[model samples]
Target: MDNQKRTMNTDAVISIRDLRISFGEYHVLRGVDLDLYQGENLVVLGRSGTGKSVLIKILVGLLKADAGTISAFGQRVDTMSKKELDDLRLKIGFSFQNSALYDSMTVRENLEFPLVRNARNLSRGDIDRAVEEALENVGLSQTINQMPSELSGGQRKRIGIARTLILKPDVMLYDEPTAGLDPITCIDINNLINEVKERYNTSSIVITHDLTCAKAVGDRVAMLFDGQFQRVGTFDEVFDTDDERVQQFYHYNFVE
Candidate 1:
């Protein structure tokens, strides 16, 4: 956000400082600084190639940053041990762009996968109750026995979210949560994002290029431009700027 070194926000669930990453000659993230606070949804707004997804990857340890300090829930992500990182991941839920469901597994089976693997000590009854609660939260209890192929686009998205929420994570990372959905379905997913925060009390970062999704779920919107977050504010405040890069982003979303 600035040339000067900034102190990390201790209260923030996630704190990133002067983050930089590059591939070959293509620099994906120049120097990103951000904070995701407790119980708040921070939306990272950008186009398809502006490193929005890359930022999420860095947060969850899928990708490493070339330079920067990343702290997740008081733990420095850049220097964590393998075992520590795995434990941290369990507390941070990530909903992928595609539903990422196992086509062979039923909805119930999909939800049980993570719980059974990570929380191996849970009994049969515990697993069943967790699956049922997650489905109910997403209002998809009836789809418990159905396969992923049988679900509509929206239903698959809900089930994807159910699988993520089954862990009761402390933080959530949503990668294009409303992508590939109709207008009504997009709105449904937006409402579900908010409901997830309320019910789970989880700090979240929602990555999207969709203006409607950003407006609906974000408490604060950070616009990514040229590998850096040029503007960070509420939905209206970010779009109200006179910066051309910011204006171009808003225009693109408007036309899309």
Candidate 2:
């Protein structure tokens, strides 16, 4: 693509250039570059403790990169003021590695919390409509009154997804959406991720170790290893590549 065309086509939902992150002496990310385009689902795959979660934290401003440029929605995120960060956050939805629901609230209340806290201009009726829409989107319209303790693992994940959807964020970051679920629930969540993209035209970055889940949701995949992106390509290209480390990791985790 030409420079102008590339710029227009990119209009990237999130951009990271030369990103480097460290926790004291341990560097988690090293000069990584990535661009998430509008309405695309990009999965970052890596083994345990490979900085997948930290990458997402950097995008959302929960953790700062030691050195890098992070731009979200065309604004530089790394240097954003607190107000700007909060504004940016409101446009991005995050589903934590754990569901991170409040035990004190029922599913209905949990879904409404963001709308109540951040969407103060919305009327009571508008909030209710948004909550119902979010629940319906995640196939949880009937579980509105259920508390966190009353739900199954899969149900909690779905509820968390619903909460994320309530904001209708332009970009959604999912951290291990199906980590501990049953095989059937894992597939269900994967399908739900696809559905969310189709329904809302939302862009996403999924952090996952599940190769099956990765293939299900990703239009393209990038392997993160040794604090950098080892390789990135379409599922077919990356998975079927002849590189020894890529082949070895896939065979070790996926092939019996």
TM-score top scorer:
1
lDDT top scorer: 1
Q: What lDDT would each prediction earn against the true structure?
A: 0.92, 0.89
Residue lDDT tens for model 2, 66-131: 997888888889999999999998889999878999999999899999889998899989998999
* Residue range 1-256, candidate 1, lDDT tens digits: 4455467879889999989999899998998999999999999998888899999999889999999999998989999999999999999999999989999999999999999999999999999999999999999999999999999999998999999999999999999998989999999999999999999998899999899899999999998888998889999999897888778877877865
* Clashes per candidate, residues 3 or more apart or on different chains: 0, 0
Q: What C-alpha lDDT does candidate 1 achieve relative to the native structure?
A: 0.92
TM per prediction: 0.96, 0.94
Kindly report which residue pairs in candidate 1 clash with one another: none
lDDT of 1 at 150: 96
